[model samples]
Target: MAYKITSQCISCKLCLSVCPTGAIKVVDGNHWIDSELCTNCDGSIHTVPQCKAGCPTADGCVKQPSDYWEGWFANYNRVLAKLTNKQDYWENWRNTYSQKFSEKLQKHQGQVPA
Candidate 1:
């Protein structure tokens, strides 16, 4: 199995430095885990890989989209939505992305935001 990184990655550079084989590299000016070099040494190189590990400053240093979504569903997201009263707005926002995957993504993101 190959290791991976997600869009949520904060480009922390932790994974890259922790890699033993230097398989990981930067793409589009962002650090990405290179599967070829992952080594499955998942934890041998560094303690917890340092990406998003216990650092308050890092939001999603290492992310799995499915897991992240599940965790979001678990947390007080529903309550937060009710408090914000922006639920319907976000629903419409999601509908806007109901297009073909790449097209919808392109339409939604004209430029990457920090």
Candidate 2:
């Protein structure tokens, strides 16, 4: 019954402060919710889930699917390959240049230097 933060999160940290159990955290520049710590605001201070209520972006906070993939890296690679139409190339790119790409993305987002 925990909520999951999607890529749509703007890293605003709104959910971080609002979560009663402090389940939300920033990981690799994305906001993620620790399911073990999440209480879904069922009997907590808030009547509703704080993460979902505080999120600025629509659909940024969503209920964790029952069959959510725990192996995110594998799922990510598969999706990337499908979208780019280059499975091997994308796999290689992710393995070889992901760090550089992340750094560049951070810089572009003004979170780091170019």
Score candidate 1 by TM-score against the native. 0.39
How well is each residue in 27-78 modelled by candidate 2, as lDDT tens digits? 6887899999998988886888988987899668877755557546545765
Query: How close is each model in CA RMSD to the real structure?
Result: 14.4, 14.8
Please tell me which predicted candidate would have the highest lDDT against the true structure: 2
Backbone clash count, each prediction separately: 0, 0
> Where does candidate 1 clash, by residue pair?
none
Q: Model 1, 106: alpha-carbon shift in Å?
A: 40
Model 1, stretches more than 4 Å misplaced? 42-114
Q: What digit string (tens of lDDT, one per residue) describes model 1 on residues 14-89?
A: 6665566676788786766665555555757555544445323423344333466665773456457555786577
TM-score for candidate 2, please give it: 0.56
- Global lDDT of each model? 0.57, 0.81
